[model samples]
Target chain A: MRISFSTTLMVCLTFVTLGCNDDQASVSLPESAKPLAVDATPYLVTTEPADTTPVGEARESLMDGESATLIGTIGGSSKPFIEGLAAFTIVDQKIPCCAAEEGCPTPWDYCCTQDQVKDNIATIKIVDESGSPVTADARQLFGISELSQVIVSGTAKRDDQGNLTLAASTIYVKP
Target chain B: MLLPWEYGVRNLARRPIHSGLTLFALTTVTLLIFVVVGFIRGLERSLAVSGDPNVMLVYSLTSEENIENSSISAQIPDLLAASLSATVKHFGITHHSPELYLGSRVTTADQSPGLGLVRGVTPTAPLVRRTVRMTEGTWPQPGEVMVGRLAATKLGVPTEVLKIGNQIEMEGQAWQISGTFAAEGASFESEIWCDLSDLQTATKRQDLSLVAMLLKDRTASSEVDLFCMERKDLELRAVRESEYYQTLQQHYRPVRILGWLIVGLVATAGIFAGLNLMYGALAGRIRELAMLQVLGYKRVAILVSVVQEGLVLASAASLIAGTFAVCWINGLTVRFTMGAFALRIDSLAILSGCAVGLLLGILGALPPALKALHASVAINLKAV
Candidate 1:
């Protein structure tokens, strides 16, 4: 009777654990390919009717997939992509000039302060011919150091959440 | 002067139904106390396991600063990297990770509204928070989201059931669950993390909550704090993650206090129920006690036998409850505002429950056992 009781108690506990457990180790992910290599000198001077759109304009700019050229200072340069994802968001060179307004050093979010969050910051990713993110990240292949000025040409796409992204076809370092 | 141990044990065996009922009553009390103590320990462990001491949260100087509301310049990470305290490092990385936080209403798989704390993190986030590791899938892509292991529990669903291929909708957009991450005992396990820029665009708020960096030197926190103080124009404040959580405990203080109050009330009622059970068990046995006294055993021995029966019943009940606790209660997750933490039934909790069980048994048997011994041996014998 004691053994029977113990077994029943254990069975009930196992059911309870299976019911509300938080471990996700059993959940499997879809199979994926090894990361793709990036092009060493992937940048090309494209003449695809591109406009010298300001980074702020890119924020409110044309719909996704339209080509545009932007001049900005690469920010978040210290470590752009972790490993799997190769993307970077850069600030327009003019963002620092606007610091003299009502706010000084802004809280990083920039939403709570009276001054507007700098719209000149644009997210950019280097993509292959099919427009998927390349395995070899911009920093890994091209040494896209942080805060450096450059003109990049890419398709302006809004990720499903409407975050502006520039899928780059060509990037030109300013001489 | 005590009766043989077998006499007390056999007396308990004589009325199996009464003994079972008494055991059950004591078990209920012991279980409640055990669960309550487990909750308090779990809460403390959750707080203790989170945040690096040197990894200060640099945010707006306002009291209202939280993950979602606090914002600063886009160049804040760069500014902090320049501060260069000797103790601070980003593991293998060169700088800190800037993150955005938002607490929004998320719908569960069952279509119920649940709270989700969404974090938009740069890749360097893991470098600063060294505890986090990917359990499944790769790092999140722009359109993808990774749910923490406890994220689903906080959303009132099973974590294992939240599959990797499943998509979750928020603000009229669907994000694929690409992966899951675990942070050991930290509260970060209850969050959903996506690419920083994607979240910024989705929320349409391009700002950051704070920057995080790993600290090697224990005293580096003060130096970081001093850096923030000097940069008052930056409107940033430095807070140790542990200290922040300790303060956060104050916010949940009322809940903890209320848990203890409920345990106290229920425990008192349990003791009374056990007492009533003992009274009823002994009420019918008054003649047996008088007969035992008449048969040459000391009155003191009869009293000892009755008390012995109480202890035996309590120990049996506690055994059952303790088994239940080990199998079911230990290591279970409890969800709250900050995140979900697992209920911990360490040695202390088990010992406490057993101690309470013994106390209840003694209290329950004392009054009736005394009355039975003192009340008229001759009157009882004549009435019988």
Candidate 2:
């Protein structure tokens, strides 16, 4: 009787131990993300900007906060458009995206020209009054898609690495 | 008064065959639970431990979270090392490791070809993958390759075939086995590592899959993220190593759910079996139980004695099963899409098995015991 009682008691203790779970540690998403709202109609213009600099040349010449008009095709990566933001990558017209390459599934990614991509591409982000990138998807706002040619007039935001993000105030979607 | 515990013990001893069968059934059920629980724990641990909070992964954002399919410029690692030199280096050495990761057909001298996860890495890979330790021989030099401890299981080959000095064919090259390594039971243990340049030359691929960096501290993650965001032209995405594996864990939640469902179904079957055995045991003891109740023993006391008999059998069965699982199932290898991981029959698995056995005894015996007691004392005493 004592043996049975002891065995049952041990099993009960085991049950209690089994009920505990080891908590898994996880990293949280960044907290700096903020809401953005912008009206694309006010920023859209029918006239293309004059003396527009090529994306690659503008990248070399543009300084931080300098006003410039840049022209490029709407692609430099597979996912050119950022999710939940009015931003997309544009590559210099000279750099051939994979569109003409044989058996290239993601033509807009410029997979074949990856070596020159870093120097030839730039980001275009539409900004509102406070300068935050618009929260809406760029594809729907611009009424344009990948491979579309367009001109953007904005202040060039250059970081220490010389990578460019054009905070666009005007956009002309070529007919 | 309650029936003496000796009465339950003696009753079990009087019917040795029935009691032995019941014990066998319980052991089988409990052992199955141990195996399933061990599988889930092993997979979860493999992913969880694979991530280091201090390490970060830089890969092409276009790959859509598939690191193997990522293709980035070869110079990205050098660029990152130069850009984040302050927070990314330790002891005058930059902690960046450029790697080429992919799955390829592997062939050992004696075994048929099989698909294996392969990693092309530089010497600095050890800096970021801190959990890895070379267990035998030396690191891969030029034409040689290093295999992780579980590499054999991942490739569906025997352990003897992968020892040092053996040769394995992959990417149209036959490379000598240089050494074996373990990654503290991380998923990396299922991979085969070789020189980055050697793999690139053999496969005719100049691009790299990703770069892994060991940050000086958790705060340095922001610097890496800042680099990726600024250099959006490179189309790179930075993710914490731990967060990457956590995403993989979430991806495999369905498999874990399936594991729990199997446990539930198995436990249910065991309960039914227990119920059948208890019903049989009670049928033969109705008259004996009625006499006990008539002789000043309460119905509740007789019921308690029946439950005691079941609990004793369950406890013994759980003990035997737990020993067997720890001996055989522990560290047993299992293969999946990510790679192979061992079945970890740790303390939790053992306790879960014991709990299942206890449940079998309690849940299986109660219904019939209650039904027997519901009858009046007069009807039970009039039994043939």
Model number with the top DockQ? 2
Q: Residue B221 lDDT in model 1?
A: 58
Q: In model 1, which regions exceed 4 Å deviation? A: A1-175, B90-92, B108-110
> CA lDDT of A64 in candidate 1?
74
State the local distance difference test value for candidate 2. Answer: 0.87
By TM-score, how accurate is candidate 2?
0.77
- Alpha-carbon RMSD of each model: 17.8, 7.9
DockQ of each: 0.01, 0.17
Point to the candidate with the largest lDDT.
2
Q: After superposing the true interface residues, what Cα RMSD does each candidate give?
A: 15.8, 5.2
Residues B1-384, candidate 2, lDDT per residue (tens digit)?
A: 778879888988999999999999999999999999999999999999999988889999889888999999999988898888434676778888999999999999796798899999999999889999999999999999999999999988889999999999999999999999999999999999999999999899999999999888775675576567668668789888998998999999999999999999999999999999999888777788888878888878888988988998998989899999999999999888999999988777887788899899888888888888778888987866
**TM of each candidate vs. truth:** 0.67, 0.77
On residues A1-175, what C-alpha lDDT tens digit does candidate 2 reach at each position?
A: 9889989997887676655656444466432233335467877898777999999999899999999999999887666776556778788999987756378878888888888888988888877768866666667777788899989999999988678989997889888
Question: Chain A in model 1: its TM-score?
Answer: 0.58
